[model samples]
Target: MGFLSSLLGIIGFGIGLPIGLLVGFFFFVYSKPKQVQDPVVRPLEECDTTVLPDLLPEIPIWVKDPDYERAICREIRRQAEPILAEYSEKYKIKAIEFENLDLGTLPPTINGIRVYETNEKELVMEPVIKWAGNPNIILVLKLLSLQITLQLVDLQVFFAPRMTLKPLVPTFPCFANILVSLMERPHVDFGMKVLGGDIMSIPGLYQFIQVVRAFKLMKADFLGLSDPYVKLNLTGESLPGKKTTIKKKTLNPEWNENFKFVVREHQSQALQIQVFDWDKVGGDDRLGMQLVPLKLVTPHETKEFNLDLLKHTNISVHNDKKYRGTIVLELTYAPFREDSTSALSAKFDQMDSIIYRSSSNETLSKAGLLSVLVEAAEDLEGERHNNPYALILFRGEQKKTKLLRKTRNPLWNEEFQFALEEPPLLDKIRIEVLSKRTGIRFRSKESLGHVEINLDDVVRNGRINQKYHLINSKNGQLHVEIEWTMV
Candidate 1:
């Protein structure tokens, strides 16, 4: 009986102990809240791809157009309205209607008298010229050109002009020495809030919207209509094929109404002219001249001169000591042609054309700029080639930075400008000059001081005309203009 009782008690304790422990453990665990993982958030969609149905205007005509200028303006309106909406909220200000206008205002970039138009809040210009020495460059402002209007809750209404400047240009003012002051500097914090950190403001970042606009403004054409933006002042220079004897060209009554000029009998030295022309048709003259001279056989080549050349050519005084067989020119006039051809090729039809399209009566972009742009491309043409055309571009003069092989993508024509790989540091630019079908051997050499580039139609010249009259007529000669941008 004792053995039976003991065995039974031991068995009961063994089973009951384990069961009691398990029950208590389960109750303790269940008493507390169940553990749960936190919810994750899908990151905000990218702003670039963020489809704001009301973001851009319903009319996408500007987007379809290849011109970024129009697109930028529309983008300004698209972007500005929202920012202003947010800006008003942040500053606790109401965006009021635009007001005030002055056309006789000028911003700093205007080297000469600048012509500016504004909604009394912002300044927009058709053409702005900034002379950075050597190159007299023109700038056609490609921006929304808008001014702003704000309200301080019945206290006062204010207006501001949006600035038109690149990011770095405003940051480091003294480095470039540009005419315009650092555009009303962006509150970098404000700018950062609008533009994310992923971007380093490159050349054109108006969308980052740092440009300061004006409410009251004035603009003037530093130089009026027909006033030459560039000029050649040839003062006290030597001419080719002359010494002390003055050769004279005279009109004879007996001759068939022709004027004749004669070279002196004793003078054998070549006359050289020094050309001082603007470096760029637009922008600053940051381009450095490199005279890649063709191999010269002798130290003394007969020189020639011509008037009415698009670019002013200057000839240096022939150095008698280290005489070379190359004719020297002093270039005083800058090339004005945008396309290789002459400007007269394109004629604007003044009869019927839409000038600048306006948004509001106070729109910064208006009829003025549009009026000037008309007929700019009437006569423009690309480089003509018979065979497959390949475009070549060099970031620097060195072959290392050169694009070994390039094929152009024709923009509007069969010929397209080559977009070269940017050099690690943008140091220089070199391009291959071609004269096809003109049967001319153009010689260009990059050198210092003694720089001279000559295009000679060896086969056709001498039989046709003594001067470049034939070359000019065939449109065989192309001009090169340099422009500068601070990246």
Candidate 2:
């Protein structure tokens, strides 16, 4: 009897729960308030100016923030089409066109702003931004015989970024430079629809979106023993290649080095990466090499590659089987700016009267200004007195720096300039460090060390900052910076 009573009670409770839910849902759907009023719309002139301040707290923050100004979506779309077309041509896409682009009336909101005060020529602020927008942006892509349509919907983003306006001036813009930096990883959410079906809802596709969103925040091998170093250069260039420091006695070495090169012709140029085994007493041995064509890299985009090293760039049946090793690299190419290119052209045109042409079909480069800076010297020593000064000689001109007395390390920070009618492609500059005796001595001045550098690399590469080991000196080095600018 007790079991039957418990079973009956359980049935009654289960039945009553659904009935109560139905009654509550019915009231929630059908109930109306005692007082209801339609919203009133008025013109701006009729609204009281004094009451506007009271409604500030009730209005949305995005509407009141100056940073949340409405964007001209039509102008943005017009400007973006040409850039998209350029990228499409680079990737060999048949066609890429915008089907529809409307960045709705909504704008990003600034939740908070923090300003920093410093005794410098800069203004810094950090703003927390949140944006949930309904934008209709559709893209149509064609590849060979296939055509694809992509639609973006329900986009959201949240980020905190620091902005800096530096070196305030009395000019129109007031700031010389504006810098923007992210404090942390940004959160982005969006839905992509392809062919009117939501692709984000598909299995495994959502993970791809997460992977791409996370990407926004964005090697070696050896035989028994080797001290590996890498040399990087662009092919078809006359300048010397950049190199990494040697890692000693390791089977696997990681030289996380950064290098920049001026690329004149991206379609014909290739980056040559060569690895070598450094030796203390003898010449370095070539370990392996690889070539990365510049055309394969998109401008201003970083791409990673784990490439297999080869004996030479000529890949053959024999070279394919050789297991040299693999190299990991991040490559980015930036195209030359139009203003700089035009300025260089104008300089060349101005120096056309002085341009020299040889009988061997060789033409001299245009005139350029050469700058030499004697920064400092390290570990320099003299026999008599360590009162060291630097003497710079270029062509027929000579310059000298102030002598520092009784110091093994001296910082001159002196700069010298040379005006020339043509590039010094085959010329060389000599820098000698000499020490002068303060008191009476047999020899007033003595040579500490001297170095001669060829100007070919400086002219080709535009600028070079290097520490050169002094000739005929033990553990002495000279720091120098050279810059060549077309006049």
Candidate 3:
């Protein structure tokens, strides 16, 4: 009994000693008070305050279809209300009273406007509000976060006739850059919470969802012994193309390759597959190319297709006649659809009888308008004194800006409007900046440099305001903005 008692004491000491030391150290280190620093507060300035004047109002916009615009505004408010409710609770703010909120009063401008109605990332538009009257009014008024989404399936949105907000600051002078969305159509949104670390819980942003497609590059019946490999592209910007592993020296090479692409809209885009023959000596030889329209795919269902590879031809031939070989492919579109109680619950009509549905076709065909603002050009290279003028081309319609004389950098803040029923999304908008001749005749025009922008980018991104690198030159860039409106 004495030995057992002594042994128990030793065991208890062994265990308790270490634990006591650990606890002592933890409290000794963590129990100390932390120094809290006072936050620096900056006073708001009044006089000479640079207000980003509503750029939308300066450009007068006309909407032909008032009913369509009203429908879009109604949908936008519906989707935004619940989102505002969540924001109000999370931020501990007063209940957002949208009973007085009307689409007729919302600002109709492209300034700080973003559409979050695709399978893309969750759109959080932060509109900064400036107090025009009582500074202390900020304490009483709670600023709510605005999230914009489209209620349509095809992911189309009407952005004209911007809504105005007046009741939010009826007593106080408050200016907020409210972000709202007016939608038309949608594609696929599975409402995924995490995709490769992306939070795509939203209903409509295209980037939130992805499509998995498999290509069975079964036997290429080429004329020669070629090491065949396949390259896939989404056919928009110069995104890096995907390629399959090269199969060794056989004309009939079978390459089963799988690839994934982020889809924006259904019928507005296509996947371009180009087969090339691998070579050790020189550049890879072009075997054949084929295009698969994205509109043919159904969400959550796998479909197989035998696509015929077509040889390069100057004349346009039907897909049946154009042949190099056939590629057996399988594709599945995985979209993220948020469950009920989510911010967006837009019911879209399934696409039926709509052939070649695109922003140019389904939405823009009836009443479509395109506005191109030619802002400026920088770092142009060529002669010492170059008089630069811009030639803009879309489909068959062409417009030119007034010439800016004898300057390497030209600033022509000009806007051109294109009235159209259907726009060709596959075609490129050609912009060529030319310099008038200075010599004896001085009548001929010289191509300083040119920029070709894919119209699909303009259609997808709502408004494109960026500088494009000039082609056929080492250095030069053109600043341009494109806005699309559907009446």
Candidate 4:
């Protein structure tokens, strides 16, 4: 009876253990939570590390508010003020004022934006930004007695990567990422100039002319005894060609015509002379021609040319060995000199007596102080807009007046001083009125008019307050006063 009972208990234990294992497996599978995901958003910095981003994200709706615009302006000023302070501290300029900053042609806007993926590491955006507007930036800088106004429009700004933001200055941090991306490409071009114009632009100096006095041409025409004339032309110059009167029925014709040409740039100038035979029925026949360069002649020296005329192919005469004709002319060149147009000639008309007086005594030579007072100007040339300013140059030193905006007339009552070691008789002062172009892409200076004042007249009169006419212009006059004091 005991053995029978043990067998039945073992069978029951095995069945119970198997059932317990099955129940625990089903519970583990049903109780665990399912894996879930949330939507992802990436900032501009999260663009792919290996690939460059081609799209810009849309601006948020909040950025379009007027309050945001004001904030941006405030931030720009706050950043710029410290930089300007550094410049002022350098002492190159005395004081500076940052007056106004406003939107230019086009405003800022954003099109749209989108995000994808669960990694929160990448995003694609479509941003529309048209930075077309005239941003007004009025900068007033005080240097000496001059009050200069620099109007900067359409300001383009950029930021470099790894730049640090100073403390206490409010800024838009989002722009930092955008500006950094822009650093990958070049944006601006820098240029520098040492001098304004050529040496001919100096005051008091003059350019003389080269005069050619032609006499006659001998046997110029290939055909026998043809009516001939001489024509003088300036190669590479726009001046009218000079011609001699036609001599009827003569192989050797005499002209006695004088032709003069200004020697502006001597190296690029040449004289061309052509002899032509007159015809009653058909076109005139070419006899011969010769070209002479202006650089071969010395200044203030007279030279003679009896050149043999040749054809366009450099051939004198194809059939006749003695078909050559010579042209006789006297060439004289008078170049610029310091005393050429100097008013000193008018002041010391009796140069011989003055030289004798100076040799007699050296005590008459005394140093003095020179004063120039610039008053105003009127009838300046302009079309669309004009920002006129005055530039004064003396002995290679230069100074400027404040800019006057949008006017045909400008007033600048300014004073300047110079200490002379010698007499002011030899010096000349140049004053140029220029119009400043404020366009962002087109920044240049247009000359309104200019005047050169000889100091000899000012020294002789002690003080000269008069209106001077502008050069190379029909209208415009400048008022100025000069005084010389013996110190």
- Which lDDT values do the candidates have, in the order given? 0.24, 0.68, 0.55, 0.59
Per-residue CA lDDT of model 1 for 1-487, tens digit only, reads: 9999999999999999999999999999888777999997454365433343335444244343446554554565566567646645543444422221111123224422334554443343333232222211111111233222211111111112234322223232312222343322211100001101111112110000011111111111233111111111112222221111111221110111111111121123122222121322553221111121211112123222221221222345332232111212321111111111122124323222212111222222111100000000111123443211212243332111111112121111111111111211223233232223334545322111111213112111100111111121233222222221111
Which digits, one per residue and each the tens of the lDDT, describe model 4 over residues 304-337?
7777766643445464444456777778755422
**Cα lDDT tens digits for candidate 3, 306-364:** 76667753246544463466666777664532222112223222222211123323443
For candidate 4, give the lDDT.
0.59
Roughly what TM-score does model 1 have, to 2 decimal places? 0.16
Overall local distance difference test of candidate 2: 0.68
Better of 1 and 2 by lDDT: 2
lDDT of 2 by residue, 1-487 (tens): 9999999999999999999999999999999968988899887569875455466554544454534433555577779889988867875777778888777779799976879999999999988787988788788877777775777776777677899999988764578888999865665546445542111111100000000000000022244577777888778866667788777776466766665565546677788888787877778788778788877877557777777777778766357565777777877644322112222323333211221112121223555467798877878878877999999999887889889988777667677767565778899999999999888879989888988999887876665677899998998899888866543
- Per lDDT, the best of the predicted structures is 2
Q: How much is 125 displaced in model 4, in angstroms?
A: 34
What TM-score against the true fold does each predicted structure earn?
A: 0.16, 0.31, 0.31, 0.30
Superposed by TM-score, candidate 3 places the C-alpha of residue 203 at a distance from the truth, in angstroms, of 5.8
